[model samples]
Target chain A: MLNPGSLTVIGLGPGSPAQRTPEVEAALAEATDLVGYAPYVARVPHRPGLYRHASDNRVELDRARHALQLAEAGARVAVVSGGDAGVFAMASAVFEALEAGDPAWRALDIRVLPGISAMFAAAARIGAPLGHDFCAISLSDNLKPWEVIQHRLLAAALGGFVMALYNPLSRARPWQLGAAFTLLRQHLPGTVPVIFATAVTRPDERITVTTLAEADPALADMRTLVMVGTAATRLLPRPGGAAPWVYSPRSVPAS
Target chain B: MLNPGSLTVIGLGPGSPAQRTPEVEAALAEATDLVGYAPYVARVPHRPGLYRHASDNRVELDRARHALQLAEAGARVAVVSGGDAGVFAMASAVFEALEAGDPAWRALDIRVLPGISAMFAAAARIGAPLGHDFCAISLSDNLKPWEVIQHRLLAAALGGFVMALYNPLSRARPWQLGAAFTLLRQHLPGTVPVIFATAVTRPDERITVTTLAEADPALADMRTLVMVGTAATRLLPRPGGAAPWVYSPRSVPAS
Candidate 1:
């Protein structure tokens, strides 16, 4: 009768260490404790029998109850989360702080592993801008009630979908992405294709290709991400002499 | 002065062979020739002095001139592309057949390596449905003009974004995703969310989660992948002993 200390979580993708994943580097070299939030534990890469906790991004239920009290004291923890720890990070505050505290973390052994978010590394460095049907929002309201995120930004802009705009503008919420771009200009159609990637696969990244009325939420911060296409996200012209990317068409061949 | 003979696109993520990367398995163990387009070269795993080729996906300029004629006969080519090889794959038909053919692939050495796309394995099995600012389109138009993808889906649903739909419906275009979901419900908000997912990270994957007026498009095909969540994509309640997942609220906790 001895099996109760697991929990993995992982994801660290879009910030790279060769885009982690050898099963999240063997669950961070077989963890033994690691939690996160302190700059995602300073982007893991230094090991000395591990054991680090670090927190600072709004306590996520006290970092999911200190990684379930170090997996209820059996160790092997882990919890990182930079991109894919089930998307919006911290695996739902470790499953809502293990269901608001113990049921014995239901006998531990949880797992998640899968990263590369940041809008799929800004839709792979601006191209295929997500290739059709899309949605993702977080204009920051401080916990639901900016009239329910402006009624989900007027219902994902009347649903002609294709969006991904995380914590859009930071510095204490710079006018909530300019009031979600004045309610997506009351039903899209301004020339679309607004990319603005930023630090995608690292190495000082920065991509831009505007339109949504010349986007410039003061050149976004919080490590930027904003990709808003659909109208079939185009902007091609790259063949041999690389650079111009974004594509979306999948049919229309016969003139 | 011996440069001209290079093309190395790579990616092969979302199918795990320990999620490749050791610099794409040492550029496919120092390729002698690989070129792709056949279940992505059967997800690469058999080695023995490489040399593959495989094709049959409407030959993008004959797999970009047969990987630049096996890198201009000097071999050492790679190609592949399952995810990050610059998104919609084959590294933009190997740089549009090296900028519309022969200028000596502009002195070779074209690296890419940044895999794991399939919307980051379906946004890591549901949750953080691409935690913010997203766009990715491809309702399958073959090449372009469907009035330029319905004007980029009406500028990504009027720009309150989050999307990632690639080659959405198939079996010869089943009414083009219901005519791009009736032009995104004339601008989104039929309760957004959407999902679909499919073989994300394989193992015969599925993941449904619907909305946008209960998506159908005759139940999407082409190995599905739809996403679409903005205005903070919700659906939480899986905490009871955990393991279901579905989040998107990037920031909100300053009551």
Candidate 2:
């Protein structure tokens, strides 16, 4: 009889060590093999019993399959990601691989451990831009067409949802953020607040708040998490004359 | 001259002690006053120097004002929420109060400490239903209107986004979940997966995965976090005939 091995997908939270949850830490501590993107896997401390498998970005399916195979071979495997594994991370890739791979692979013990998503960390750094109804969409067109992203952005804006845009820019597609801002300006007022949160929770984190008209798409890179506020979102003045805080009110007056 | 007092809004995460972040714990240890709903405030441990002010539900504005006043009076104040403070919690209420109250109130040193949101915790428990583009809406009509909620449900479904619905039902509003399901059925396929995750991260936690056609509105209560999947969401089979895991694939084939 083979000893039971398991697969756990864990989020490393954001950039800081404090962001990692105790549960995730425990899972990492017990892992026989750890697999993920290079930067994320590097965050895991080197332990005597752990075998680290670091791969380049965009090789998610290969990474997922390798982790699954290790688990199937009686190894406690942990696949890691920068933020929450479920949000634009390795969890979906693992599931995709498991669905397409061996049917017997499905019976392996697999679990996804949630971490503080980048959007939430960014929102907290500011006040609460996503306090009301909100939608999160990846602006990267690698998986879907640009048309679908445009349609969903329009619908989200029309629906009065505060939006969190992940993967706003990439090396290959630098113009996508500009297109997004141009489309949003047509329906939204120029004064609507937009937040460009870069490298959140890290020592070098930066958060800039601007209006839709004043926003320059060039400011956003792959590392930035952009938040577009709704008509009801308000910016509260900060004490001591610092930057104003942004938040969406919980209650909306019935029109 | 008095030193400026600070205010920190902390999310207790979901249920377990391990879920609370170290930053939140440090803030709690330093706070002179802890304020929130009775239940959330109760979660804070009794400390020698801490003053606990627990209020009833539905008095968010009052609670927020009280916290601000305490901060202004040179007391370190922490307003606690069950999940992430930015998501449908005290963060919004505090901003609302600051906007409507005296202009001087805006100058208080305030920060929101992020936590693991209930929806993320629930999603992590059963794989990743929110793996792709997704929206989160609170079903309670007390803040907005039923029409707005209904419109959002249709828009999210039509836009092909996974939806995480908060406050699905309460003792007073028993019919809202059923109404929401009925509206979603018009646009979504009957085979779409719906997850009812109750008391997540707690001992009484229960997870049920059902198709939209087979789902029962009665299963959801105030403590439950409901996730409705898009067409791209898949349920992976489990070994030994356990419940299949649910997740949304990251890639979408361009139509």
Give the alpha carbon lDDT tens digit for every residue of B64-125 in model 1.
78788788767888888676665666665665566567776556666656677777677766
Candidate 1 docking band? incorrect
The sequence of per-residue lDDT tens digits that candidate 1 reaches over residues A122-164 is: 7656545544445666666664557656666665556555667
For every prediction, compared with the true complex, DockQ reads 0.14, 0.80
DockQ agreement of candidate 1 with the native complex: 0.14
DockQ-based CAPRI category assigned to the predicted complex of candidate 2: high
Return the interface RMSD of model 1: 10.8
Candidate 2, residues A81-130, lDDT tens digits: the string is 98889999999899889989977777788888888899999999889999
TM-score of each: 0.34, 0.97
In angstroms, how far off is A193's CA in candidate 2?
0.7
Pairs in steric clash, model 2: A107-B239, A239-B107
Model 2 residue runs over 4 Å out of place are B2-4
